[model samples]
Every structure is written in structure tokens, then in C-alpha cells.
Target: MLASDVCPGEETIAAYVARKLARDERDAFDSHLDTCSACQELVAAVARLAPSQSADPVTSIGAASTITQAAAEALRLPGAQLGRYSVLASLGAGGMGVVYAAYDPELDRKIAVKVLRHARAGDQLRDEARAIAKLAHPNVVAVHDVGRADGDVFIAMEHVDGVTVRDWLRTPHRVPEILHVFEQAGAGLAAAHRAGLVHRDVKPSNIMIGNDGRVRVLDFGLALADLEPGTIVGTPAYMAPEQQRGEAVDPRADQYAFCVALWEAVAGRRPEAGGRRPEPGGRRPDPGEPGTLEGVPDRVRRGLRRGLSARPADRFATMDELLSELFPPVPRSRRWM
Candidate 1:
């Protein structure tokens, strides 16, 4: 018997319905489930009911992430190979599935693949795969392939070798270096927002730093429509106030986060637990967060302050504006060649 049989009331109903939908299409109502605890609990229950197929202990950073990691660990099957790609090792897990480092023998390529566990084995995974595949940008990580193998749904993407923005901030860097990183990151976010996608979760962990000193955004799993309020998403520290209350959002939301990240990078301290303070003439100066713009060029500091505006409308309308300010077009000499 399934766990749905033992659950009471709406939980059972939600579980059965979700499971059915998950069987049909895993991504169909992922945004729906992310916000609904009853549904999330049901999904968690279904995962718990599934027998353990592997002996590995699921290691994760926090409580909310455990559900996804544990679920991925349970769904791992034996001797399953797909389309010239061999699964090598588990990278990490998120709210919905497990990502693994896979090897492609035919082209001699390495890829990071995420597979849905439990009810996410079907359409839900497909939808996320499709949504992410549509976005092709240098700063935005690309989705290479999506399909199913041995009853599990999978997404194969470019494997980036780098540390997260969170990892980079573990130690202090020169203020100038921090500013350059923030400028690049803001450019990426602006590009994605322009394409009509909202990255619901934009914390330090989701930002990857390449060995070449480039910053890229990862995990569009929680992305949604700019105006929708379906799922209450994002980590608390980096999450905007509206996200916590399940309200509408847009590019400005991303801009706000970019500012916060910049703040943390430069100041090396989390912003105080208060909303953005308003300023006259539609401008607000840095709240004197020590070293916020210390050692950075004044031009970049002005842009960062604008992007972090409490009101979305008051911030840069597009990432292009922010990038141009951060990295002005420098003329190159033809004689160099």
C-alpha cells in the first residue's frame, strides 16, 4: 500500500493527486508543491515510503535541503546507463532531485546531470528541463539535454568547475576584486530577467565563480513568472520581503539581491535585518555598512547603490544599464594583432 493510504484528509488527497500528476508530468505543479507544505509533506512521505536502494548517507547543508537529497539517494538505481553517458559520482541534491557528474564517452565530455526522485520522475522534470533549455546565455548556465533513463527523469547541463559566491566570501578579498565580481554577476542576472525569467532563489550558493574569474548563476529550478505569487521561494537571508509573503516579483527583485550579494562581498557581513531605507529625490546612499564601497572605483559604487534600491521601479530597468556602468566599452587598438 502507498503512503497516501495512511495519510489523513487533504494531505492524502494532495499526495494522491500530486503523485498521479508526478507520474504523468513531474514539473506540472512543482511551483505549486514548493509553496504548499501539505503537498510538500505528502511528497516527503512518498519518498520516505520508497525503499532505500543505496547504502550511502545523504549529506546536505540544512534541513529543508534534506528532503531533496534523501529523495535522490533513495531513487538511485543499479547499473543504469543512458545514451552514451555514464554516471560517475553524485554532485549534490536540491529540493527536487539529485545532480551527478556524468561522463560522455562518445564525445569525451563531462556533464552535470540532475534526476528527479520519487514522483518527480516524469513530467515535472520535463517542464523544468524545457524551461531551462530555452535560456542560452554565456552567464546563464545552459541545459544540454533532458530525458528519462531507467524510470528516472534527468537533465544534463554544462558542468562548471568553480566555487559558489558563498564559498568565495569565506575569506576576504580586496574591495576592488569584489566589485568586479559583483558587476559581472549583475550583468548575468539582468540578461536572464530581460528574457522574462525570474530566478526565485538568488543566494550566494546559487552563484558560481569560475576559475577564470567569471560568475554564473545556477539552479533555475525555483524560477517562475515575474508576476506570479504561487510558490513562496528563496533562502531567508537573501530572499526579498515579498518572496517570504508570496507576492509578485520582477527584475527589480533580482537587482535587490545583486545589491545584497555585493554588500556581503565588500563588507564581509550580512546586511542588518531591516528593509531598504528610503531616500529623497528617489536616491538612497549606502546605509554606512562599513566598507560597502571601500577601495572600489566610485563609478561602480554608484551603480551598486542604485541596483539595491528597495523599490523595484527605482532600480535599473535592465541589466544592460548596470553592466555598461560596471564595465564601460574600452576601445581596443587594431595594431595589437
Candidate 2:
């Protein structure tokens, strides 16, 4: 049931598929699982073959996370080994899986390893990897590598040592600074759009701010193409009307989410449910419900209002266009030399 017993050309992982072992022995196997990336991936492979394993949670989501934390502590990843990277510490865990700050000996740099929980085919993983690999932009967090480790599919990504856009908004910032940050984020989305990709999820939490003062759009996990209608994807408050209606989403959906994030950043609150968009024929929506528009410029507010329009057609055609409306380039006169 453990990697040690089976790793040396013995019975395969299939032989240990969710096998019941003694409590002490299970704990020991879990310890081995912590360091052996190969074994971890093996577990993931079996999980794919038997999806029911994940459905059996010991308790609620929060309790599961607590148990996961306890398990991690017991393993204590210090000097922990993986395929090609040494795990330094656990950065955080989300619905998908756990992420660790690791050191890549070959690259001689720090990287983030995201281990996805679900089982996806190798071909699918490779295709997604290829697409993400092509998206190389300053504003987009780079995906350095992707491969199966042991049994889990892990993504090696460029680590940005900083806070999320959500947390960043909690700190005080000037209007210009806010606009600048959002512009950079918009650039990332624009890049994705040009590559024929729509970032279905564009909440503030998906945006990362590096300590180097660079704003990057992260997590393309939900950015899949041709999602069937009725696919409920994205955060509710930040979701576009079309998305809520279960219609196929496009770049305009991202525009709507961007507007929501910007609005929250400025107003310090999300747009209420049933809130109407700023459309001429639609019911007039209160632009002041989230409180005074102090420090929010008229141009910025107007752009946000339009982007937040319920109809996708009413919103900005592209992320770049939305940015241009919010920040038109200043004309420069050249002196005759």
C-alpha cells in the first residue's frame, strides 16, 4: 500500500488503489507520499480511474482543508523533494489543489507548483500546456512547465512574491495608481483575447501584484474554449449577464468582470444582485449605491458603467478598447530640430 514497498518493481499502484491499511502504516505511507512526486502522481492516476475516491470526504470543505493542513504539517515539506524541484513551503490551497513555493535546481530559481486535484488526460494536459505556453506577456504570469509528477498533473509557474489584487485594493492607493494597475491587468486580458482565449474568470483574486510593482493576471484554469451553454462559470457578483443566463461567454464576459473588479476597487463594494446595467433602454442602475464616487474619476466611472452593461454588445468591444476609453493617449507635439 506504500510507495516504498511497491516502488522497487513490485506490485503496481493498481494493487494499492484506496487500500485499507493500519493507521500507523497509513501515516508512514503518507509521509513517503509527501516527498515522492512520482508516488503523488500515481495516486492521482488511480483517482482518475476511480473518481469516487474524491467524493468521500471525511467532513465538510472547511474540515477537509483543516485535515489537509494537519496532514501537510505532519509531513512538513522542509527539504522535501519532488520530481525536479525542492518544495520550500506551502503557499496556499484552493478548490483545485495545493500550491507550493519550490526551488528549481536546474533553472536555479523559485517557482510555484500547482497540483490539480481532478484527473485530466495526458493529451488534454499537453494541449492546454501548449496554449498557455504561448501566452508570454509581461502582465500575464508565465507558466514555465507542466507535466505529470508521480500521479498528479502539476504546473510549474513563475512565482510572484506579492499580494493578490483583492488584498492590494484593501491598501490605500491614489486614483492614478489604481488606474495604472488596472491598465496593466487589462493588457494581460487583451493579450489573451488576441490569442483567441477568453478568461472566463476575472475576479480580483485571480490578479496578482508582484513586489516589483508589476500587475499580472494569473490563473487561466477556467479559460477554456467553447464551453457549452448553461455552464455556470465565474464568481456570481463578477459574472456577466450572459454567463448568468447560461449562454456561451466571450471576451465581453471578461470585460464585464473587469468592470466589476474595478468598481469594487473604487467603491469598496460589489454591485448588488439585480443591479441594472447602464443601458439607455434598460432600467437605470444606481451608480452611487456602493457609496460616494469620491476619488473615482468621471471618465473611469463612465467606462466602468458601460462595461458593466448587462448586454455584451453594449460593453467595450475589446479589453484594449475599454482601456483606451478609460485612458486616452496624450498627443505629443514634436519640435522641429
Candidate 3:
């Protein structure tokens, strides 16, 4: 049976899991599982609900013993209502929450719905929504709505049809192409900085390239209006020194992460991971040092080195400044000449 032909139920799933289903039925269910996300989720939930080996297996197939409760709700299958939007399918999930591809009946359009993990995370989700909603740049994902549903906070935003920069980098790209994508993403980050908000988490995975060929910076879950000293946040590999030290951060910190991502894209490895450690006093090794950025151009290496500086002050004062360094403007000829 194909995915469309399968209508999974608690009993059917339980029978399949308990090995009570006939060979043909099991084969058909297996075929459906290949493409049915809802059924796949049910199978996972069944696994979780399974009793220990010492205990008798679930032979009876009524409701699958707790399958219809929390597990079912967590699945958020198609037609499930989340605030004003109807959940179509789950796009992905992370530490923050699960992102669902949903449809807005009133607006008659599809949107990405991020259901935060913590029910009490409404304040933070609202903050993120407000911060992103204020940014009108083409490189920033647009926020459409934010609300609470069934004790969960959800943010509705633009549904981008594309892959993360991390995935995009899986395919080899020219230096110019890499710079072009990051330039657009940097513009979005710069726009956030201009609005007095700091994206505490900026990494390659947080940046995406849409099917329309536009690059966008997204997932401002850690963003905030005011920096609180001693509050550490962000991915460790891409974090600036200050961010890792629990010190207050600014736009320059984001610049450091952007450079790290760019460096990885160009050099095929992170600076530290490439076996280059910081010099004494915690400063990064000079870009001009031998064996660093071997094939990269001098100008690009210089900009990346500065952006990855240990001290925020040593890095570019603003994202726009760093972008300028990475993609310098063509000089105009003098009219008199």
C-alpha cells in the first residue's frame, strides 16, 4: 500500500508493533511508513510506549496503551489546529521547539509555525516575533503572527522553501557564490543590529537559502533587546570568546560567528578545528600567518581574521563594515581622468 492508501490507527499500529499483523498487512504498513510521517511518528511513539523485555509485550491492541494521549497530541498531524493555523506537517525540530508547515485559513496561505518547547516561553517567543517582525529586509524571514495554543507558544512566520546554509554548503560552491549568499544574510543581521536587537545565536544552520534564490537569516529565539551580563548563549563552535565567557554581547559578536561560518565554507573547516589555536593572551592567530587560509585571497582572510578576533573591539565595528571587507565595492574612475 502507498502512503495515501494507509489510514493509521492506534490498534493497527499496536498490532503492527506487537507482530500480530499478517505478513501482507505488515508489508503494506511498511510500504506506507516509508512516506507517511504521521504513521512514522506513531511507530516511534509505540516504541517509546513498549514495555521492558522482562515485562509482557503489548499483545492487546486497543488504543496502544497511552498512544492516544500525549504522543498523539505531540504528533500534530495534518488538520490539527494550532491557534488560527492548521498544521500540515512537521518541517523539523530543535532544542527550541518543533517547526510545522501550517496553513492559515483566513489568510489563505501557508506559513511556518514554530511551537516553542516550554509553555511558559511566551515572553521569549513574543520578543523574538517582535524583533523579527520589525525587520523588513528581504534577507530576513517575516513574522506573521504569534499566539498561545493549548499551553504552547507558537510563532507563525514565512514558509521558506529551501535548505539551511549548512546543507547548501554540502554542494561545492565558488568563493563568489559563497560570498553572495553570506552578503544577503549579513544584511539581515545588520538590519537587526540597526534596530537595537542582538541575535545571540548566529550560525550557518540559522541561515537559509530559499528556493527563490534569496538568502535569509532566521531563528532569533535567543535574540534580545538588552544584553544581560554573565548570560551565556549560542552554539559553542561558532560563539565568540565573550559570548562563551558569559559576558555581554553586541552585533560584533554576531560578526564573529558570521566570519567563522564563512571561513568554514571557504576553507572547508573551522578555524580552531583546523588545528590553529589562538595566540597567547587569547587572540586569534593572524590570518597572514603561514598555513592559514592557504588558497583564500589575502583581503578575504584579513577580514575573516579580524572578524574572528578574541576581543569584540578588534572585530568589525558593525556587520556592514565586515560585509564591505568581504565584498569590497568596485572603485569608480575619476571623471576628470
- Which candidate comes out best when scored by lDDT? 3
- Per-residue lDDT over 215-332 for candidate 1, one digit per residue giving the tens place of the 0 to 100 score: 7888765552212336555554455555545678776677667666676677665454244433433334473456455666676677777776666777787767877776677798
- lDDT to native, each model: 0.60, 0.68, 0.73
Ranking by TM-score: 3, 2, 1
For this target, which candidate reaches the highest TM-score against the unseen true structure?
Answer: 3
Candidate 1 ranges with C-alpha deviation above 4 Å: 1-84, 116-131, 149-153, 224-229, 273-285, 288-293, 325-337
> What residue pairs clash in candidate 2, if any at all?
38-150, 41-150, 41-151, 41-152, 42-150, 42-151
At residue 67, give the lDDT of candidate 2.
37
Candidate 1 positional error at 293, Å: 4.2
Residue 8 displacement (Å), model 3: 29
lDDT of 2 by residue, 77-126 (tens): 75776678888977654334567889999979999887665534757667
How many angstroms is residue 132 displaced in model 2 relative to the true structure, after the best TM-score fit?
Answer: 1.2
lDDT of 1 at 34: 31
RMSD of each: 10.5, 11.4, 10.6
Cα-based lDDT at residue 21, candidate 1:
31
Candidate 3 lDDT tens digits, 1-337: 3243756667677676555666457646754653465566656455444533224334432454466563565667889999889999887643345678999999999999877554334466565667667778899888887787887667789999899898888899988898889889999999989987788778887899999999999876565322345745456667788876788778988998898888888878777665566555456666677877777777898898789888888888999898888888879987984
